[model samples]
Target chain A: EAGVAQSPRYKIIEKRQSVAFWCNPISGHATLYWYQQILGQGPKLLIQFQNNGVVDDSQLPKDRFSAERLKGVDSTLKIQPAKLEDSAVYLCASSYGPDRGTDTQYFGPGTRLTVL
Target chain B: AQRVTQPEKLLSVFKGAPVELKCNYSYSGSPELFWYVQYSRQRLQLLLRHISRESIKGFTADLNKGETSFHLKKPFAQEEDSAMYYCALSRSNYQLIWGAGTKLIIKP
Candidate 1:
C-alpha cells in the first residue's frame, strides 16, 4: 500500500514571503495531521483534521499559519510572512482511524522549508 | 498539558553493548505511548506501541505508569540499530505529543 504523499520535498523562500505545502494522505485514511520539526527536535503538531473538519489546532500560529482539508483526503498548510524561525521540515501524517489504540500514523517524506 | 521528554540528545555505544533510550511523560490520565524511528533518508515510522507489548528489531519498551516513563531498550545493540528515536504520547483524538528525539550511534 502506498504511504502518505507530499509535494515539493524542499522549498526555499525569503523572509516575509508566503509558502504553502501540500499533502495527500493514504487511501481510506480518516485523519490527517501537519507537524513542524525544527532541527534537532521532534515534530511539533501544528494542526489535526478528522475528515474535512479540524479536530485540533491549538498550537497553530493563528496570526500566520493556516491549514485546510477540504475533501478529507488532501490537505494544505500555509505560512504567510515567513520568518527565519519558520525554517524547518514540514511533515504530513495520516491514520486510518481516530482511535489511539487501533491506529498508527504513517508519515510522509516531509518538505524542508528554508527561509532566507 | 501533555508532554514527552527525551533527556538525551545523543547516545553512542559499541556494537554488542546494551542500549537504552530514556523517555518520560507528564499526563494526568492514562495515555497510549509509542516509539518512532527514522533511519537515514527514510520517513518516520512507528517502531512500537506500548499497548501491543511487542518487540521490533530487538527493541522493546515497557510502560511504567508509576514512574510515567516508557524507555526503549535492547540487550545488544547492532550497527544497523543506529537511528533517530522519538517517544510520543497519544491523545484521545489520536494526536501525538512527541519528545525531542534521541540519536543513537552504534559503533563497531
Candidate 2:
C-alpha cells in the first residue's frame, strides 16, 4: 500500500498570510491526523478526523487554524494569519482505525511551512 | 494529564557499540508505548510498540510499568541507526502524548 501523500513540500509566507496544505491518506484508512512539529520538538496533534467527521481538535487554535476531511479520503489544513510561531513542519498521518490512537500510523513527507 | 519525556536531547555513540535511548512517561492507567524514528529526509516510521513485545531493526524496548519507562536499546549500533527517535504514550482517551525526541548519532 502507498504511504500517505502530502503536497507543497515546502512553503514560505509572510506573517498574517494564509496557507493551506493537502493530504491523501493511505487506501482504506479511516483515521487521518494533522500535526505540527516545531524545530527541536515532537509533533503535536492539530486535528484528527474519522471518516469525514472530526474526532479531536482540542489543541487546535480555532481562531486561525481549521481543517477538513471531506469524504474521508482527503484532508486539508489551513492556517490563516500565520504567525512566526506557526513556522513548523505540518505532518499528515493515517491508520486503519476508527479513532484508535494505538493503531500504527503511516506518515507522509511533511510540508515545511516557513512564516516570515 | 499524560505526558512523555525523553531526557536526552542528543546522544552519540561509536559504531558497533551498544545504544540506549531513555524514555519516561506519566499516565494514570496501563500505557501503550511506541517508538518512532525519522531518518534524514524520510517520513517518520514506527519502530516498535510495547503491546506486541517485539523488536524491530535490532531495537527492543521493555515497558517497565513499575519504573514508568520504556527505554529503547540495541546491542550493536550501526551508522544507519542514526536518526531522530520519539517516544509516545497512548492516553486512555486514545490520544497520544509525545516526547520532544532524541537525536542519535552513530559515529563510524
Candidate 3:
C-alpha cells in the first residue's frame, strides 16, 4: 500500500520570504497532520485535520502559518514571512479514523526548509 | 501541560545485547503512550503503543503509571536496530506531545 506522500523534499528561502509544503495522505485515511521538527528534536504537532475540517491547530502560529485540507485528502501548509527560526523539517502524517482500534499514524518523507 | 521526556540523547550497545530506551511523561488523566522509530533516511513510523500490549520487531514497552514511565526494550539488539526513537503522549485524538528523541546505535 502507498504511504503518505509529500512534495519538495527540500526547500530554501530567505527570511521574510514565503514557503509552502504539500502532503498527500494514504488512501482512506481520515486524519491528516502537519508537524515541525527542528534539528536534534522530535517532530512537533503544528496542525491536524479530520476530513475537510480542522481538528486541532492550537500550536500553529496564526500570525505566520496557515494550512488547509480542502478536499479532505490532500493538504498544504504555508508559512509567510519566514524567519530564521522557522528553518526546520516539515513533516506530514496520516492515520485511519478513530473507528480503527489502533490509529497508528504513517508519516511522509518530510520537507526540509532552510530559511537564511 | 503534557510532556514527554527521553533522558538519553544517545545510546550504544553491542549486537546481541539487550537494549532499553527510557521515556517519562507528565499527564493528569489517563495517558496513551507510543514509541516511534526512524531509520536512516526513513520517515518516522510507529514502533509500538502502550495499549496494544504487543511487541514489534522484538521491541516492547510497558507503561508504568506509578513512575510515569514508558521505556522501550528489545532483546538481542541488531545493527538494523540502529535508529532514532521517540516517545509520545496523546493529548487528544489529534494532538500528541513528543520527546526530544534517542538515537540508538548498535555495534557489530
Q: Pick the candidate with the highest DockQ.
A: 1
Model 2's alpha-carbon lDDT is 0.93
The TM-score obtained by model 2 is 0.97
lDDT of each: 0.94, 0.93, 0.93
Against the true structure, what is each candidate's TM-score?
0.97, 0.97, 0.96
Task: State in Å the error of residue A68, model 3.
Answer: 0.7
lDDT of 1 by residue, A1-116 (tens): 99999989999999999999999999999889999999999999999898999988999998999999998889999999899999999999999874443569999999999999
lDDT of 3 by residue, B19-100 (tens): 9999999999899999999999999999999999999999999999999999999989999999999999986574678999
Q: Per-prediction fnat values?
A: 0.88, 0.73, 0.85
Best by lDDT: 1
Ranking by lDDT: 1, 3, 2
Chain B TM-score, structure 1: 0.98
Chain A TM value for model 2: 0.96
Which lDDT value does model 3 have at B76? 91
Q: Let me know the DockQ for model 2.
A: 0.79
Worst 10 residues of 2 chain A by lDDT: A96-105
- TM-score of the B chain in each candidate versus the native B chain: 0.98, 0.97, 0.97
